[model samples]
Target: MSDTPQDSRRRYSAPVVDGVNKSAGRAMLRAVGFTDDDFRKPQVGIASTWSQVTPCNSHIDELAEVACQGADQAGGKGVIFNTITISDGIANGTEGMKYSLVSREVIADSIETVAACEGFDGLVAIGGCDKNMPGCLMGMARLNRPSVFVYGGTILPGDGHTDIVSVFEAVGAHAKGELSLIEVKQIEETAIPGPGACGGMYTANTMASAIEALGMSLPGSSAQNAVSNDKRADCAAAGAAVLELLAQDIKPSDIMTRAAFENAITLVIALGGSTNAVLHLIAMANTVGVALTLEDFTRLGKGVPVLADLRPSGHYMMSELVAIGGIQPLMKTLLEAGLLHGECLTVTGQTLADNLAGVAPYAAGQDIIRPLDNPIKPESHLRILYGNLAPEGAVAKITGKEGTRFAGTARVFGSEEEAQARILDGTVVAGDVLVIRYEGPRGGPGMREMLSPTSAIMGRGLGNDVALITDGRFSGGSHGFVVGHITPEAFDGGPLALVQDGDPIVIDAVADRIELQVDDQELERRRRAWQQPPPRYRRGVLAKYARTVSSASTGAVTDLPDTD
Candidate 1:
């Protein structure tokens, strides 16, 4: 609100860096390498979610240095900082995985704490894990400061094509006597070649691309390889871009409008992105006070087509798509076709149309990204279904490879571990709908992803023949006939807790309903007798989250009501 850019820049940072009265702040800054010249420039916090926990973020230290260089070169004093991260891959299928989703809130809180206390004028946040991208965006939205988000970049596939998804499926094959233990061991060894996110349209890449679509990241920044010069260049550009954001006072909320969120959702549909995006986008939008509901995603997906033939449900990897150029070409196709809103604001201080004005489409004969005339799927691969089972809503990825409808007898498991034990033991067979309840947000107390069970089903050659429904969620690498995020969760006494073995369940994508085919009278009787279970955790962060977190349909956020 100041008259001059310099005055506005000092509105926050000057309290710590510019005043003689605040000598203690300057002393602390001097201890950390801040000089007189540095004190004269606007302080920009460079937050890096770098850790050796997983390959996804291991390489971000070098990128942080690149960002500092960018900021210093652009006349801003960049101070690099670190935050906590957890490896979803390392913790998958274990009790520890309960902390994966919890890490998102911690990251946002810590980043906000550092910025607010340090009194930085702007921010450049870099994240690589499944949760880090959205966490950073949430912090930025809350801060409402000039900011830019940078993706660390997607990882390369092992042995050129097969990756961690292959390794997960290999365990199922070994269980079914389709793959030798030696071969499965080899797959585990070569699945991850180096540092980056799981090399597919998994959660990391999905959120990365989604952030770009949200106009928080630089153009074409989501698809570059993690170890490439282009990724470094993009990181540097983001650092410089944040200074521009500060100069123009272009805050994230300025670019993150309702139409902008729609543009991001449209891109997710085209990419056949992860179901987690539905949850994360809602939480992020809620930070900036945007009303993003499951119905909104369902409506926006109606006009978009699944044009990218990338992994999990498709036959391509992110690396392959990168070889033929990245998301820009595909975005250009959607923008020109009028599927995307071209007038939406971007991080570049230009309209989406301005960014795409000189962009080119994917080269001819590149089967990685299909043509507009002949798309992989006419409608979005992601679907939201509601019925007796999920009155609030549930997410399903129907890639068209898995038919539009599935009707089968339910095989109930009260927990994911129980379901996995049965699935790996060959007890889960075809023509069955596996029900894993009591694993939703308040149920599992974190709503773990079922990658192990889903991969096992695929490896056993039953990916298309069977279906799995859960109140929890799935990894981005999970495919086949699957439905997740059922609400209200079983712990809160939704219909899922009432499901018994042999009950006929139907998941009809064509009708957009996931139903439990029992009489209304019987359902009412069961509900009368059903009782909520005791809390799985009675202490610590997970317990706190279980207590405060809301339904999955509302983004599983822990914030107070928005009635304000």
Candidate 2:
């Protein structure tokens, strides 16, 4: 597709390494092990999100090496680069968690900065955690280059089928005297056994599956174990696939179409993925200039069913799903059922249906993925509710197990720590709707996930009884009757900011509404008296994020039109 004749693969690289005028650039690259022959080949930037801050990304360094090898073998000169990854699991409840969503923006910016500066002809971004996955997609879409994303893969379950969620809940269990100190310590020590993303179908797995379904990743790339040979193969294949994509001039814009996004939404709904998918998918779509909104999710959810019985609300983990032949088989089922767009192009240089052509169905009698007719929820478990409480919209994950409707007296808290403390103690009980506000994108300056408090609620045995509504987001691992991503965040004087203790709140998933049971005049009166809190951080990235991040309803993206 490019007119450059100096080695066809060197479309972008030729300008940087071919001419005599570019000797300085070439000289710098030479110091990094670039040979004369390597300079003539296409450059493939492997954006590696390898960090020891979390186990999720700890193994990605080796995966990056595998990808680079594949690129070299495919006749492209591979250049490895690093990006930052913050641990949402470790930062969930503390002030440090405010950097969680902010990290997504930072990751995207860094990847774009590196790729653009290097003038790489293609990219293979490897992400292991929740934020970095979407961040990778966003960066690739920005570059509009021949790119492939590789998931670091899901972690294996620990002893007794426990995970990070088990550890958070164990703390609450210990607080409630349901588990001894030794028992809690045992769970804390064993929940995270080794490297990989969270074991369940949390945000990491959800985003990986969504990206694969969006045609940005290779088939089965979303379903391999972190330490498995399959994952290494996936990384290598992604690297090789980018060369094919470069040859065909198939950029991310060509693959990340509206139809492709619809396929992604369908698969995510069917898989019972995280509500964070709504945020990340919208963000990714926005980056690619695709018009996706919360309403699109509502439209798609009407037909898509929750089939995968895995995750925080379900019975299994991603490892179990991987053992049962991954998501390819399920995709085949969806395609046959007319739920997926068969014509959508993918990184494989083939249509989505073509990729799934030979994918075998899940083995007979596997309960991991329920049949369509006997689906886990019959429709999507993700409900986007709008009411006085959420003037724009709010996301709620209702698996029917948590029931579709909840009405309770408000138990207000200003932050996650407050709510978490109340939940751990005997303060938060049944018939309570925990209103956790001032924790949205701009409000929290990072839109922290409320995994700790929600896990605590479950551990305290009030999951079925209590509900939490927040302007902040929830972790994919946080279930129960919880609503998050309330728009016009509390910091901006959203309705959530006006809520007070003992006020009645009703969340009706069937009606798709989250209402405050108060008179309009009273709400207006309270709004008139409400005062916006001072910025939590006076300087640094958090302060900058607070000043620039958009509302949760708009994907919480920073580069959008006027972060306000």
Candidate 3:
């Protein structure tokens, strides 16, 4: 008979500890609490994305212990390891933000290195921040190991606002003399109540839910308070879940399939999730050789309603949705609408339908997640626009509340700082498309999130009037009439590099187009004259990244093992 998943010969760690020649390896492990009995069982790696940089991941260390405990209780040997993390919230708008997206690759690489070198049979990656979720999932998929992901959960927003994005918009309002310095200071003081990712349906929460919908995490693992017992239980449960997956020989590739990605896209759009979902999901799918692209987003997202009434585009907070019994109710709704691929396999070794079984419906009168008929938008909030301005394509996140069409004069800035300065000095006026260029993956050396300028525009009460476009990307918290991820980036002489001050630009989200009024000859001449800037860093991690990273259109992933 074929060897069962529980057979000793089937475990990846068997050779590392079972033989006499490997006694030294077992001895070192024994120093740290491993026993001969433990050596006989599975070695499940606990990959924790924990750091003191932000409250988002402050609790993961303890959660890792909880996972270890759960693994030990389940008759497996849990070995804890850590990967690097950078705080996007702490880094936003500054040079520090350059490392935010770059850290995703680092996290994934580190996890794969540790897991493979350590001979772990299975993995449980505990993540809290925005990039960490996708980073962990990418590593898990790359290793093709039996793995499970655990989300640390969302932060509790204090009395002042729902999330850090609120404080960002408040800074804009404060600069425009709308709010006094005292009010802005007050918001900054108490915006984050405790540990977790930035509140709202931002990148962190978005990817967490997307991973769950993609079947990496356990059911109902996406929504919950960071410090709650429920989150603690989920972390522990993830520990046990990976073991179960190993018992069934169910690996990440078994679950991270094309159908699963489409379901994830459906969930992202249905929850009104981050535009980063497009980039990160593409990256994760690429790791597994899945053919997910921007066109897949456009095709799958059609007629998929933005049903969640959550921020940064809508009225409620993530906490409000959590109050309605978490994402299960929402997923259940999608399954009922036939919007989800219910037959896909999850880490549970069961179909998505099996995991979602017995999930209770939302309580009546909860407006957090809207009903299908009365959606936040009749279609997904995200759009991919095409025209002379973005011939390779660009991403526009339309919350339905933002302006449908805008004809504007281009106010060009070569860097984010320059754009922020102009906005703060009140130089940015209505009918201006603030163009920030040369900040794509290779150009910026790390495509930074454009949260500061976008928030300032909203705070200045010019959200509907002013529009911004960049070769870079945005924080999930960013809203308003903004376009980003302009491919064939400015560094590569993209159309964004040709934009001059006073150049007429028109963005029509309703028509799904962005047109530069300049004729082809003018654009061709500007492109010919354009010179690619010298590399910013001659050596170091950032330099390596800029050299290897691809465009944001293809997820900006740098660690493709099979790539040319």
Top candidate (lDDT): 2
The C-alpha lDDT values of all candidates are 0.89, 0.92, 0.88
- Candidate 1 Cα misplacement greater than 4 A, ranges: 1-5, 562-564
Candidate 3 clashes: the total is 1
- Model 2 ranges off by over 4 Å: 1-8, 562-564
lDDT per residue for candidate 2 within 1-564, as digits (tens), equals 223453676767777777778889988988999987887678999999999999999999999999999999998889999999999999889999999999999999999999898889999999999999999999999999999999999999999999999998988888888999999989989999999999998999999999999999999999999999999999998889988998999999999999999999999999999999999999999988998999999999999999998978998999999999999999999999999999999999999989999988888889999999999988889999999989899999999998999989999999999998888879998999999999998878788899999999998889999999999999999999999999879999999999989999999999999999999999999999999999989899999988887777778888885336
For candidate 3, what is the lDDT?
Answer: 0.88
- Candidate 2 weakest ten by summed lDDT: 1-10
Where's the lowest-lDDT run of ten residues in candidate 1? 1-10
- How many Å off is the CA of 148 in candidate 2? 0.3
TM-score of 2: 0.98
**TM-score to native of every candidate shown:** 0.98, 0.98, 0.98
**TM accuracy, model 1:** 0.98
